[model samples]
Target: MIEKNHIVGKEAQKAYLIGVANRNTPYEKAKEYIEELAFLAETADIRTIRSYIQNLDRPNRATYIGSGKLIEIRTKAEEEGVSVLIFDDELSPMQLRNIEKETNLAVLDRSALILHIFDLHAQTAQARLQVELAQNQYMLPRLTRLWTHLERQRGGTGTRGGAGEKEIETDRRIIRDRIALLKKELEKITRQDEERRKNRGEFVRIALIGYTNVGKSTLMNALTKSDVLVENKLFATLDTTVRKMVIDFTPFLISDTVGFIRKLPHHLVECFKSTLAEAKESDIILHVVDVSHPQFLDQIKVVQDTLKDLKIENKREIIIFNKIDALSADERETLETAWLSKEDAPALFISALKRENIEGFRNMVVDTVRAKHAEKFPNQKLELYS
Candidate 1:
């Protein structure tokens, strides 16, 4: 029996982060990706003792890294007493098995790490059920090997009369049943959301979408003055919150939902489909990007891909470049030049933390929403100035 304390003990959990990229990736970019993996490990409550990055022509089929690198990782892990090895990329099941066999430590990929964080941050019943369903779906494929490993670790006498033997089967059955129940609950919730949307009538709806920890919650609070939870951690807000406000006496609804991350697990997207429906149903999208981050462009692409996956690509969107207060003058100048050079998308730069250019943001959103509304409902004819 694995005690709850075993899972939660800070002293017992030490992690080592690893990142690998092919010759196509620049060394600097690879390093940044590795640092992100470390941030993710920290958010999941795993202590990252070290990080390793390697450039290879291609990942090895068996272990994802070269044999020598694997051996080096094993030696370092043993020396540091690392409990978990976290990879920046998703590993194939065979690669996972190979790494575990070599290192004799718990192994997790970027997807699994994010799921674990979601599991920890989930608070509401809906959010918890969604996370649990996602976790089970992710675990189902690895169950056989995981159970075999568990059996090897926990050798016992026959005094319990095969209770341990049946535990894995019992757990699988429970998880399957729970998954079905959660699906039904989510269906009901979806129907309720549909009705709520219908009742919302002509009010314009906007949603804040962004990379995790890029200050979406802070922007939401600034825009609406609602005290949604704001934190420096990833996945801080799991449940979606919608607030209504009047900008220049024009009523509109804005929603704040869970943030996105690079390579966010497919299971999470599947499970949180209902929550993400808020974005799908919105009239406008406030796509926030952390302007200060070196990987800001990549972050933007991830959010765009996620939005496209959610089938909200056709919706009106304004790129809100956030965290300008943290950017150096040269960096700010570079970003401004980049934005000016781009002619396709509408973009705004602001510091949500300092409340700089918030009024400008609000005005831009109001004007955009009004234009979209007029375009949609030509007969109703709402003027922007009025």
Candidate 2:
């Protein structure tokens, strides 16, 4: 329900990101979320001017921060000419309304920010439909904030006091209708896509997944030699791209799907279920992590939990620690030592951008795929290939 003229324009907004830390969520966790929020804002063409974190045992329940902190933030925002305030967590509709009213500025929460990024990144018709469904659902609950009050026309001063409310109701009905349509459309698309996957001739499918901007697409391209839209920005590739790949005379399919992040909106996850069906149906899951990121372990936990939620936990997995090129010599040794010593799924490090240590990745994938191939197609001759 963002205003078209203001939000969907070329002018990049100056935004202040705020996060609240409680005893349950320490300052470090809130700080990590704020950093991710800034990335989300950048994806939506917003420039974050600064970030503010308040250590409250709980949110203010009205402002999401204390009144004094809100006042301090307002003064700082005015001095910096910040146009909007982005919160690290989702705010209630009342909280959204109250904050905007007090600060006299627009407000976006982490969920809204992620949805906006998805809105920007969705390319194909299916992706667009999925994103629209999520957006409409998010808007439906916040209609009051979306449609502001307007008393009457200048010429007809006493014409209406509740016209704004009526308009909001009308908009809500329209959005609800649109959401219904979008659901049906997506179901049809999902069925069609399912048929296509079924007819793809029983190829081994590998799904690449990781936190956003951590070289998942780079690994996909490097492994399959296919062009995927890769960028340094968050959620750069929203639509799934599947490519047929061959290693050691055994052919399989690989897909690059949307990257995961901390605190992804639950509604978005539901809306993108059809898009994630590829991963759920895959034979192998490549959980790529950026070992270079300071909080890579936290990011890894987030992705693992997401996979479990998606019920993709049973797939044979490979933990790929990517972007060794960004690490110092000492850091690389330390990561390899730590990961290599662990008794878990096979772990390997590579700089996909630099094509480093990729041969090892291929050999493992080849072995994994070959084992599956042998188990499934034992009668098929592979003496020449192996």
Candidate 3:
């Protein structure tokens, strides 16, 4: 159990972040990737004490990083009092076991870290079920490596073919059964949700899709004047929240769905497929980007690739470069010049937090919704400004 206090310790939740740079991935990009990983750790209340990068064509099969580098990291972790080690990439089962044996500290890969955050952020029963399913699926394969923790709990590892192994097998079966039950429960929940969506009766669905913590919820609140929980932490909103939003006296539906991240676990995505249907079913995608982030372009690509993976590449979209209030003068100007020139999908710059250009955003959304509405319901007359 990598508890928050375990991470924060008595004073701070210290951790070491590790990454790999290969022929395709340069050191500079790897550094940025580790910085994002550190941010994620901080979101989980862990402070990154250091960052390590191993420039290998591929990860070391046994340890992920070389044995010599592992020793250096272990020594450094001891010196720095870092309690946890976080890898930027997912570690194989063998790699995880080897690294834990070598370091003798809590090691978490990107998937586990993200799942932990999701577990923390899950509130509603549906969200809880979704996260539990993801966790169980993740745990099923990693159960073998948890013997040490089980032994620590029982105060002994027991004899060969003994209690630890039996307990692990038992836990795996329980997790498998629980995963099955959760899937059924999610099926029920999703049926109810789909019925609810269907009850809305052909409403033009516009969904806010973006990278995590990039003002999607804030923008949703700004647009709908309804608070749906906005936080700075990643994966703050786990449930798909839908609200009836009317602009220009034309009623439509808007969904603030779960945000995307780089290397989001396949298991989690599989679990949340129903939750993600809000985006897949949308008529317009308000692709929000945090223009303030230095790697905003990369974030955009991540969201795009995720959408492509979901096979939802044909939806009409509007680029919403949010948080412009935090951008530097030169960055803001260049972004505007570059994006504003594009004629395919309209791109608008605004700050959801600062409420800058919100009215313009409203007008743009109303116009877009009107156009979509006209296309869907050519004979219907919208009660505009009545």
Tens digit of per-residue lDDT, candidate 2, span 1-386: 33332443557878999998888989998898788888788878889999999999889788888878778889998999887889988899989878877887778888878887887777899988888899889878887643343112112354343447777788789999999999999999999998998899756788899999899999988887888998989999999999887788878788899999887899999999888999999888889999888899999999999888888878888899999999999989988888778757788889999999999999988888888777766777655444
TM-score, predicted candidate 2 vs. hidden true structure: 0.92
Clashes of 1: 0
Tens-place lDDT digits, model 3, residues 205-262: 8999999999999999988988898998898889889998676687888999889999
**TM-score for each of the candidates:** 0.89, 0.92, 0.92
Q: Which of 1 and 2 is ahead in lDDT? A: 2
Candidate 1: misplaced stretches above 4 Å? 1-7, 144-171, 378-386
Question: Residue by residue across 68-127, what tens digits does model 1's lDDT show?
Answer: 998998998889888788888888878887888788777888887887788778888788
In angstroms, how far off is 172's CA in candidate 2? 1.1
Note each model's CA RMSD in angstroms. 3.5, 3.6, 2.9
